[model samples]
Target: MNIILKNIKHISVNEGITINKLEQIIGASKGVLSRAIAKNTDIQTKWLVNIVKNYPQYSCEWLIKNEGEMIKPTGEIFLTKENIEETAINYKDLAESRKETIDSMKKEIMYLEEKIENLKKQNELL
Candidate 1:
């Protein structure tokens, strides 16, 4: 069997979800995945994306690159409103942190440019 098919089966088994349920979650027609696997044909990327969307606990890296564990070790994902609020706050914090880092880097770049100009002047004098 193709590695992709094997991986898909492995994911289904690991998730304790039947192939039929997987088809429903991914919105693929019944037996479509099985047919692709049996034929050893490549599964389309959109199908993979659907699977990822439906099963966020599964590692997309593993699905795509065959790297990392099939299931992510990250903490549980809850679809509750509290979790959503927390996630939004976390994202805002991350955006602020990244903006600060970019500003610092811009300052450093200006400092470096000034030093380079000074060095150029010294070289010209010599």
Candidate 2:
């Protein structure tokens, strides 16, 4: 079930950043964040993730639970383009490996099924 976000005012005030900068950091805009907070709008998980990731100092619980201090000054979340590209390449390689494994497993399953069917037919003849 989706829960409406609370304590947005507290978060904004504690962060000490203008709405625009906050939006930029989270890859959103002033209007979207403002509407969400002011109207008690449903916050998507993706948006929430972006916020928590970009501002690591901000308490994740505070962002989701609204039950604690807003900003905790945690680690940096910035990623360079090169880092992203490398990560993407790594993921592609992993996906290819997974696909190959799945294909092999499927073939093995088909072979086993065929053997089972043949054994059942032979037993019935006996």
Candidate 3:
């Protein structure tokens, strides 16, 4: 696994937060967030700063290199109303995105299923 993915996964697991939710809270798209989390790529400092600033619960060391715990030792996760409101708006946007992605994926799956069924039919005919 890429270091970014590993870090992202570790943070998500440790902090009890999803990548999508985090991305939403930070006002980044899912694709951008996914790319940023990849170890092979260099994540811009500004974006990383934005994420940490928005959610202090995330540890900089952990988010950067997957070395430390996602949460700080003190465990004082900031949950201010402003942060909540920002996160809430992102969640609202994510809700629609979630539905869209699911529908698209479902369509792709159906297409693959049809292709498999046709292949099976061809095999039976052979």
Using TM-score, give the best candidate's number. 1
lDDT of 2 at 88: 62
CA lDDT of each candidate? 0.74, 0.62, 0.70
Error of 3 at 8 (Å): 6.6
lDDT of 2: 0.62
Q: What's the CA error at residue 75 for candidate 3, in Å?
A: 4.0
Off by over 4 Å in 3: 1-45, 64-67
Compared with the true structure, model 2 gives a TM-score of 0.45
10 residues in a row with least lDDT, candidate 3: 8-17
Residue pairs with clashing backbones, model 3: 4-37
Q: What would the per-residue lDDT of candidate 3 be over residues 1-126, giving only the tens digit for each residue?
A: 666556766655554557776676566777666665654566566667877777576778777777777677764666788878866765575576678878999999999999999999999999
Alpha-carbon deviation at 67 in model 3, angstroms? 4.8
Best by lDDT: 1
lDDT of 1 at 73: 81
Of 1 and 3, which scores higher on lDDT?
1
TM-score of 3: 0.54
Where's the lowest-lDDT run of ten residues in candidate 1?
Answer: 86-95
Clashes of each: 0, 3, 1
